[model samples]
Target: MTFKNAFMITLTAGSILASHLTQAGSPVHITVKNLSDQEMYYQSTSAMTQAHASPTPELLIKGKGSDEFRVTNPALPDVTTASLRYTIGNKTCEFRTSYIRTIAPGGLFSGKLNTAPKWDKKAISSGNATCTVTVTSTNFSDHSWSVVFTMK
Candidate 1:
């Protein structure tokens, strides 16, 4: 083939590959909903046990409102641990879990944490409280796993 033809072919192939890679690297959409009448504050911490982990920001959802965020390239380096803290009124509840590796691209795992989190009496007046926590891990992969925490 001529040099001009070869260059055009190569450029077209590179563009196609880049497009596919961009589509595959879509970010995970996270939604936090507060069903209670009281305003809720939340912060999430997620990391792989390796060096140089990114930090997540603290967020707030108004009373009976919902908030959404996107996580790009989640659950890096095989395994990841995450903690989510939710505060409503005078009560604060925390949920923690570790994400496991899965073989399938879209595999999902879920669990319910029905037990109450330990609370400090002086720090939080309502020490005896119960919050239903649900943990869901979806799109299991090395760099694309998404963890969702739902508290009620």
Candidate 2:
């Protein structure tokens, strides 16, 4: 075969393999990076179709840093629902989303929290397998905030 024809054949095979990998429900590696200047604490809960995994114990992430987690739980193969709770300084915020029907194999999901004022609330979901939350202010009475990401 000509070099050009051989290259096209290889490209088509790679595309088919990628599509099969996604449909097969392979693992997804998710990284949570702390882009804020303050120390941050967080916990994650993820749920899938047949089974549910317990929420992870609270963990700490320093500023300008990142941590990685694998979403390979077979029970939560689809990971239809997930939540993230994080604490920065004396304030805490949460990001939750549901109906996340599909996360491609070898998928990457990233999230960041903007520095807070007093209280802030927001959530963002990207079509490119990413999510983000930003909090500006919160109620002084309870010192609590809820930030929910709406899936796109």
lDDT by residue (tens digit), candidate 2, 1-152: 99999999999999987765554222333345565676777644343411332233237777766655432333332333345656665555555433223223432444533222232223533323233753323333323233323211
Error of 2 at 85 (Å): 0.7
Cα TM-score per model: 0.44, 0.38
The lDDT per prediction is: 0.47, 0.44
Identify the runs in model 1 with alpha carbons over 4 angstroms from their true place.
1-29, 43-58, 70-76, 102-129, 135-137, 140-148
Candidate 1 lDDT over residue span 5-122, tens digit each: 9999999999987765554232334445676777788744344211222334336777778665544433233334444567886677665444333344332444432321211111
Give the Å error, residue 13, model 1: 29
- The prediction achieving the highest lDDT against the true structure is 1
Model 2 RMSD vs true structure: 16.9
- Write down the lDDT that model 2 would get: 0.44
